[model samples]
Target: MRQTIESRQAELNAARLRMLNKKQEAGDRRQEAGDRRREAGGRGRWTEIA
Candidate 1:
């Protein structure tokens, strides 16, 4: 009975780790997209001035 409980707890912990990893990945993607937008905007301003 105790072993079963331990196994279940381990599974839950693994799932929680996976969820955290996914959240981190999503945040990194959002940051990358923002960087791309900023780069594009900077280029547009340069083109207009030239």
Candidate 2:
């Protein structure tokens, strides 16, 4: 019973790490896309209102 609990805990920890990694990757993509958009249009173009 103790071993089963430990294995379950390990699996939970692994899942949490995977989720965190995916979240970080998404944030990086968002930042990179934002950077590209700004570069494509001039500086401050991202914040300008139509």
Candidate 3:
């Protein structure tokens, strides 16, 4: 029983790491896109109007 619980915990940790990596990758892509937009011009649909 203890071994089963430990294995389950390991699986959960591995899944959590995978999710975290995916989020990081998405964030990096977003940042890169934002940089490209800024380089092209200061015009983006999501730009806030102040």
* Model 1 lowest lDDT segment of ten: 41-50
| Candidate number of the best lDDT | 3
Cα deviation of 48 in candidate 1 (Å)? 20
lDDT of 3 at 46: 49
Cα displacement (Å) at residue 21, model 3: 0.6
- Clash pairs detected, candidate 1: none
- Whose TM-score is higher: candidate 2's or candidate 3's? 3
RMSD to true structure for each model, in Å: 6.6, 3.5, 2.6
Off by over 4 Å in 3: 44-50
Which numbered prediction scores highest in TM-score against the true structure? Answer: 3
User: lDDT by residue for model 1 over 1-50, one digit each (tens)?
Assistant: 99999999999999999999999999999777767767788565443331
Q: List the residue pairs that clash in candidate 3.
A: none
**CA-lDDT, candidates in order:** 0.82, 0.84, 0.85
lDDT of 1 at 6: 100
Q: Give per-model TM-scores.
A: 0.76, 0.77, 0.81
User: Candidate 1: which stretches are off by over 4 Å?
Assistant: 42-50
